[model samples]
Target chain A: MKLKIWLSLATISVFFVGNTAFANEAEETVTPDEELYDTSILIEETELALTEEQMERALLLDEFANDRLSEIEATIEEGNIEEAEQLIEQYEEYLERLESELEESEEEQEASEEETNEEDNEVERVELPDSDDNDENEQGEDSDEENQEESAEDQDKSEEELRESAKQRTIILQALLEREDLPEQAKAGIAKALENQKRAEENYLRAKTEKAVSDEDEDEQEQEKEEEETELQEEREEEAAEQVEEENDNEAVVKAEQKQNKAEKKQQKAEEKAEKKQQKAAEKAEKAERKAEEKIEKAEEKANKAKEKAQEKQKKAEEKAQEEQEKAEEKNEKKQAKKAQENRQKEEKKNGKPNHQ
Target chain B: MKRAMMITCLFLLCACGQGEDATNDDNNSGQTEAVLYENDVFQIEEIDGWSVDQEATAEQEQNVIFSNGTTRLIVSIVSKEQTIDTLKKDVQSSFSKKVELIEDDENYIALLTNRKENIRGDVYFHQGSEHQLIFTFMTPEQHYQESKNQINAFNEGITIF
Candidate 1:
């Protein structure tokens, strides 16, 4: 009874002490991330955990194999070459099996991915989108001969209009996307179709701009010719006005002053023409600036898409490399374990305990 | 009260005497059987008056006698290296028992006490060296010299592979 009482007291004290020790240990080891990060970090952490466990297993196997190899070395030193050779053969066979298993799994993954790709491509496509619906509808029902002629004319008009619009849109969009003043967020929102449209707008705008510039130059040349013609006509009119003034001078001096006023009117007209031309040039520059801004935005969106794709590719490559490393480690571990077991047996035999079945 | 004390004293003496008698019987039987080392190193038989202290280091055993008829054979294998004198000193310090040094050569050799009460033999093989053997024996002082002939017979009897 006394001994049992003492034993119970001892057990209670031991339990109390153990609990206190465990609580103290737990208090001392508070990890920072556990307190800070969310559950996704934990999930990401779980991915690493699997590889770590595999690596740890591999390490154990490596140690075991190394120990076995050392024992084999010892045996060789003891002139037991036959036994050592047999151990080496066993180790090699185990490693080969491990390597083959790794290769087989990798092949299986590749085959499955190939099947998925094939299935995706095998999806049957149906009809394409309507490209000429508006034109077809406009050439309505009538006598077949009239309708066919009208239809052809409408088709030709629609084709020309589409071609012209496509070129104009590509130029405008490209110019807008290329503009430096555009914000980054604005650039990201442009879609692939919008990009294609912008390209067409930019081309059309460039052609239109070139045509307008050439037309303006032609108009300037025509104006110069008209100015020369008008100058000659003015000379004639001035001469006639002077002649009229001379004829009127016999009647009255006030009539002679009207001839001098005609020259001042011509000068006022020339100043007005110059002011109007300056205003037109300023407006054209503004429109070009807007187009340039849109083009800049489009280019930014394209760059962002490219960057995202490259990042995704890099992430996938990293995942593949990690998987390969894990597989290799697992193979190594299996090999190591086999070696360790053989080594352990050899050690036991040398120690004369012969721990075999 | 006096009678109770007397009875308790008598009971204690009887208990001790019976324990001694049982121990002696165990010792005699153990001496006749061969001593087997854990590593299958060596075995010796027919020693006289053997006793074993089982509470030793996990890897080793100490102080057991082998018997051949009336003679006692004591055997020990030491697997560490030190001078014979140093080993003798360490054993004496650790075990607190004097070892009679008989043939103290490069490897270990020590004989047992030859008196009738001290008829115990001892063998010390330096398991320190890769290959070294030592064997020692003791008998009733009358048979002390005669025990060498019996000890030599062990070499002839042992078959090493």
Candidate 2:
């Protein structure tokens, strides 16, 4: 009863703490644009994740990724977006298969654990009176303890593997999120997957904590402890699921508010843009009007200057004509005078004597 | 008279030396004098009876080919971005045939093979500080012997800038 009470208290405390931790963990990155920037990053991470494959399988996967990338490029070149999308889906399926393989191996390990536990229970139930076979019984107990220790180590190792597997899933999720063109349902699907991983991480941590407690309290009835722990874990899982549902509701409400805020911001930005455009248009029209008035003023001034230039040219032409007439008159007068002198000379020659001018 | 005689002797000496030089050039005509061919990357001396086909140098991987009808030299200017081993793998895959490495040094590797009955391929790979150059020489089996000597001359004349 005391153990049950302590376990209950631990469960309650874990609930509150786990809720906060998971809520934080499950917090979705709000900026969709930032998610788009992660595509290349996720691809690089996929490459890094590939380094763990030190075998032929890893090489094959590397080759497969390269080949798929080539195929997708070719499909895109042919302008078949649908086919390219399908190819991407097929390639992602291969990645998902790795995750699923990990899950399946974990399940097989759990099954083996259950089998060992049942065998241990059977060994416990086998009633053998105190007899000469006590040595055999001790050996059996020793072997059982060894088995338990081995299973515990295996569980610890699998914990690390599980963490690794979850990390890989998270990487894939990041890649999925990076695809800005995915449908809303697809985004929701990724969200659900993230929630699942969070829950898995929580359970894993709880299991670790409980294992420590069990180790410390090993003097207690081990079988009853196991049964109680299982029940308590189940109960906690139920509570966690409900808590997740409630958190989802709260998240939705928060998202809706965020959406409304975004919409308001967008509308205000649009209004500001329109007002600025209108103001710019008014300024442009005013500038154009000023330019046109200036151009007309310049043209009119040019025309007036041209008229003045033409009048001056006409006056200059008249003056030139007058100068020519004056010169011609002087030449005519000179010719008449010369002709008169010649006439006088001719008269003298005809008389064959000097004549008075 | 003495000056005239000395001038005549000098003229005779000059004529005899010129005749001998001309005859020697004719006798050694088979040596095939080479001329330096260079562009932005590296310089190679192209030998006599060989010329680059400008039209066939349009491929992205290889930009130049020097040919003498029966024999050809393909030049690929690989950038310094890749390691030497990667360059070899690329060459092997590009040819789609196993190439035997005949010369391996810190700066270069020479790969050769007789791909066909009467045709041979020789690849001279040079790892440079700024560029990796690959020279693929293909020639008929009969000309392969002479082609090797010519290739060596070309290699010796090559100076990567």
DockQ of 2: 0.01
**Model 2: runs farther than 4 Å from truth?**
A1-357, B1-36, B58-62, B98-119, B127-129
**DockQ values for all predictions?**
0.00, 0.01
- Which consecutive 10 residues in model 1 chain A have the weakest lDDT in total? A35-44
Expressed as tens digits, the lDDT of each residue in A176-219 for candidate 2 is: 54444555654555545445544444444444444444443343
User: lDDT (0-100) at residue A242 of candidate 1?
Assistant: 72
TM-score (C-alpha) between model 1 and the true structure: 0.20
Q: What is the per-residue lDDT of model 1 for residues A1-357, given as tens digits with 9 covering 90 to 100?
A: 999999999999999999999876433221222221121122112222222122222222322233334333444456555555554454343333323333343345346545643653452122234645534433432344475466446534533544554444344334433434444443332233344444544544454455455456556656776787888897898788777767756855565466557668768877886787788777766766665566667756764674576567658868988999999999999999999999999899799897756
Residues B25-67 of candidate 2 have per-residue lDDT tens digits of 9867733444446777777666666677666554323356677
Per-candidate alpha-carbon RMSD to the true structure: 44.6, 36.5
Off by over 4 Å in 1: A1-252, A289-297, A300-304, A313-357, B1-161
lDDT of 2 at A16: 99
What's the iRMSD of model 2? 18.9
